[model samples]
Target: MNTETGVTAQTRPSATSSEGPDAHSAPPTRGQMWRHLGPGIVVAATGVGAGDLVATLIAGSRFGYALLWAAVVGCIVKIALSEGSARYHLATGSTILAGWRSLGKWTSWYFGVYVIIWGFIYGATAMSATALPLTALFPELPLRAWAIIAGIFGFVFVWFNRYETFEIVMKILVGLMFIIMVGLAFLVAPSLPDMARGMTFELPEGSLFYTLGLIGGVGGTITTAAYGYWTQAKGWRGMPWFPMMRVDNALAYIVTGIFVIAMLIVGAELLYSAGIALEDSDKGLLGLSGVLEERFGATIATLFLVGFAATSLSSLLGVWQGMSLFFSDWWYQLRGASEGGHEGSGAYKFYLAWLTFPPMILLFADRPFLLVIIYGAFGALFMPFLAVTLLMLNNSERVPAHARNGVVANLTLAGSAILFVVLAVQQVARLLS
Candidate 1:
């Protein structure tokens, strides 16, 4: 029997197709498939924040179509990681943190410290990043003032709403961003032959970190660990939902793949073609805006900025809500409180405050140097942390035998873990250097 959804092995649907045994219902139709696309969209939007765009833009600016293949590989890695995570949720019906607790108590403390530090720093970064396009578009308010306003807006939205409302807002933001990015991509009109050559897997010298960064960082992060919560929030049940999970994940990441590919096209066609170098920060996007103005005029630049705002704000809101759920669950587990109903819990509120208010200090005053160091230290290791943990949980005897990790899943997870480890070490080396 499947432990999470209480369905027997005989009734479990194949992950590839919605089709399953006669005892279970037939696969969901295309309409139903469209409906199941919730949590996946949420995860995708949350993971591909401003920083991810920066990395991809830099990669494209430096190498043009040379590293485009790495972006595709990065999406595949994300699919495998997200599939592993969603599988755990479907097989166990528990949050990832709970699964971690089963692994050992040390995981609890590790995640706690990591989030405590990372959330504080990320909150500041995300808000400021969100404020960038707004400041560019509307210079009426100072950047710091706009950032504080953005932070408060996310805080109020996440604090008062439930997951359903949160998902709706996220979908809207994802839609806006998607339209803008894809539109921008088409405007660039990259060469098809160059893109094909990029697919041939030639990693140029000196672009190894850039390549690895694309593979390791493209649409993958701590937000993935929160994916299970999204699954639960979406109210999917039964072993039969596996195919829907599969479809949902595949389609969502395809959208993410498109978004990344679009940004890369922009990087290659616009900045690279024009020989304009962007600052290796979120401000790089603003620099790109000036390019758009020079080429496509102010209207296109304005549209791009709107899209950028949608993308950054979606990340801020998703992290605000999802990680609050993470801390809330952790608090429940730590305090030995009642199993569920932590939405209004103190820990949830505390983490929300952590994500929202404390970082406002960084908008004005200096960030604590030690806190920044610790954040990068732990943050650097998060992808590998999730990959390794998923490998442990999904391969354990807890999941139904038929539902356990298959060969492809195993290899993918292992590769992701190893790649993330290399990336993490590289990040640490860079930090120390």
Candidate 2:
């Protein structure tokens, strides 16, 4: 029978059948389909935040399909990492923060400090990204005004909806984003030779930044840790749910991987061929849209902008909700508060406000140089944090031996950790210089 996690259901035989209880049965109902398809969508929606889209588009424009290999590598890393997080929850029935607490106080403190700073900086970034498309669509409204509106709208969406409703909305937005953006990829014919070469596993000259960026952007983010929370939200608890969770995480990142590859194709075929350079900011997307209009038509350009808006705004909503959950859970643990009753408590609303309002200040003034440095530096550190943590946590005694990392997983995690440390060192050195 189909389960709540939206994985492909395997059949189990009825009691009367000689084939055994885990054999064939009738197919699952449509209702079961909706129930099972949740955590993947939540994780996917969170992973594709605006910064990721910008990074992917830029990588495509610069290196064409040469960096598509990085995107594929990124997807594999995220799946490995996310599966580790979800598996921890299903195996131990504890939140990742709680699991970290089990390890030591230092773990808790590290996460606390990281989350607060990350949320503050990310709030401003997400708001600004969301506002860019709105400003372009209706130039009558200033960018700052649109940013406030987007923030408030995100706040309200998270403030009222339960987890299920939130997932539904996110899935719809993700659907629209996939159709419009990925559709453009097919319309622009790609070079089979170049795409094949990209898959050959060789890095091109002076392409380190682009390669590292694709690796970093492939659905890696702070919200990744929040996968445990989404797992809980979907009522996926205990080892019995582990298979479904694996399927959910895999399918989500696979979709993300395909979406990213499509964007790279668009970059290879359209921007790189035309000698167009994408701007460094969200406005760069607008410039790209204009290019699409010139090459295609206004209809295609407007659709691309709409897809951009959906991607950015959906990410804002997800970060606001997911991080808020992460923060509130951390606060409750620190205060020795009771569990299972904090869902929509004051702590949750407090973080929701934290993500929505204060950062708006940056929209008016120049995003302070020091703040940018701190954000970029710490942001660069998070993927490694996730990679290393998954290695430690999943391989620990707490995890069942059966569920622990194999040699393949260990090597992949180690590679990802090393890659991020290199990127972080480079980012920090750049900032200091």
Candidate 3:
């Protein structure tokens, strides 16, 4: 039915594109479950970059699991957001952009400005983050050189590979990263009883912002809205794939929570126990690396850096591909074109190019404070924006009655919006001060 590339359920070229013989053909087998889980995994891996890990580590270092429940809550919020997005796409065959446009022209303009400003700033940030561990791993290369190389590597990889191949590569990267995280957690030997204590619904003194960050910042971003495009790209369309999509989404976030939980334990046992403060940034991860080397050996430090690279590069690839999906679909819809033209289309490549190259100029210059504030405020507010809009869309008559937001979905979305607003307000206050 689409007019752009004229692609349909039957016409998708990827080997894994078919949802199944039919949507409701049968329950997914083990192999089928594995196949359909790509989109959520991409979102989780994308969102949990170095900054997220550092935030969790800082929280654990300072509060010692007093905010542990917040991390679990963060995963739950993301699951709700991911499910709502997937449901909208399958129910309406619509993109999130289209859903926003349904709300009002104001929503459209807001997203346009947000995406332009957010992507320009985030691109440079993502590259610098990726460069950090690589420079640590190979001390000879300056961070700037490593950053540009990281950006180029992400660009070339995503530019050539479609969703299926990209998904496969990311799966491998996350798997390797997972092993490293788990191994580090083991080395730290955190007490399970203390972790249990931390899980209680209690907040530490003066840790309000840290708690809110953990709640609002786990496993989500503007990229979370890209879930639908990934579902479509994965060849799962219509109501039949709905159940499988939910399963896929839930499983992905569960893995995200586990990875993050391991990180918290590392912070608790290593940094908290030792009275170490990482000063709250990606540099904290580097400081953790030095501690790991001091305690375990150089080999341990080297492995962690490798895992860090995997985490960083995985995010870079996801954003490069995920944002391209969003921009391409937006351009297609705005021009009265079909959604089918979106995969690696002109706009797709343009955004991909934007994410990779233009940001490199900022890598060479000093980062501006005003640009950081604008980026920070929007970045902080995005999840709240997403939660609020999803509440409107999924609850509206636009989605199928059966698939619309139920009580649990509504509760989670509402809670996510509130939590994000708290974090957003706090970020604005800090920036202004």
Candidate 4:
């Protein structure tokens, strides 16, 4: 029960309240589980922003189907991380922040510093990303103006609404983006034999970085850690919800895999075959739109732009709502508050505003050099931190024996840690250079 709102499951509590139905009843059957898949949809749509699509698309253009296996591998790795976090939540009945607190103060220091710096940098990043397609589609407004509008709209939307409304809107955006992207893929008519060959793991020369990137970049972000919070907001609690949670996660990533493969197909068939090299940024999608217009006429190109906007806005909304939950939980837990911060809480709104307004400055001016370095340094280490901590938390007595990591889970988590560590090193090296 939420003490502030006096909300109970019987009262149909708003998502802003954070308390879900207690796990006193039996779990839903498989037949009934489909409808309970909101959290996964939220995570999937949130994770695959424009940057992720760009990375996969670049890989497809460079290597054709050779690195297709990397995209599939990326989905599997994220499943391990997300499942571990969600399992800790269900098994121990604690937020991930609580789990981190148990490990040591180091976790707190790392996360506290990380989230602040991350939110500031990411706010501008998300806004600019969402604005790119919009600016392309509507040339009357400048990019900076569209960026501010996107940020404000995201802030207002998440601020006023509850998680249920948020989830419904995300579902619609996901369906819109997914259908258009996949439709473009089939319209290009990808070669089955080449894609099949790409399924076998082979890294081409000079492609090591791209291969690692494709493996690491697909739908992996801070939002991945927010999965448990989404599940909690969805009213799932305890071990009884495990089967439903697993289905929710697996299906979501499976869709992510398909969505990624579609982008790769577009890259291979549309860009690579035409010998076109796109600028390597969010604007790359805009460049792709020009190519689309030339070949498939203005209607298809306009549809792609709409899909691009949907993709970017979905990510902005997810981060605004989801990451704020993370910040809220972190803040309250730091104060040793018994009741966790939920959607409508002061801490939640603070982070939401922090993500929305402050970043708008970057849209008008250049990013500060020191801030970029700091952001990169902190951001690079987060995945490794998540992977390593999940290993320690879930394998320890914090989780019940049955919920502990098995051999496969252990291997996958360990591999993820190593992969992230290597990526972190590469990022730091690039920043320093």
TM-scores of the candidates are 0.91, 0.90, 0.92, 0.94
The digit string of per-residue lDDT tens for model 2 on 136-195 reads 888999888988999999999888876778888999999999998789888998788888
Q: What is the lDDT of candidate 3?
A: 0.81
Higher-lDDT candidate of 2 and 4: 4
Best by TM-score: 4
Report the candidate with higher lDDT, 1 versus 4: 4
Over 1-433, each residue of candidate 1 has an lDDT whose tens digit, in order, gives: 3322333333432211122122144447777677557888999999898888989998888899999989999989999888888788777655566677777789989998888988988998889999999999999998998999999999898888877788899999999999999999999898899888999899888999899889988795888777766766676645677888888888878999999999999999988887889998788899999999999999999999999999999999999988887888777666554343245457777889999888888888664454444555567688898889988989898677887899998999899999999988987887686
Clash count, predicted structure 3:
0
- Better candidate by TM-score, 2 or 3: 3
Query: RMSDs, each prediction?
Result: 5.2, 7.6, 3.6, 4.0
Model 3, 124-233: lDDT tens digits are 88899999999998889999999999999988988888887888888898898899998899989989899899778898788888788787777868888888878777
Model 2, 20: alpha-carbon shift in Å?
Answer: 31
Where does candidate 3 clash, by residue pair?
none
Clashes of 4: 0
Flag clash pairs in model 2.
Answer: 4-36, 5-36, 6-36, 13-23
Q: Model 3: runs farther than 4 Å from truth?
A: 1-32, 338-341, 367-373
Q: For model 4, name the residue pairs that clash.
A: none
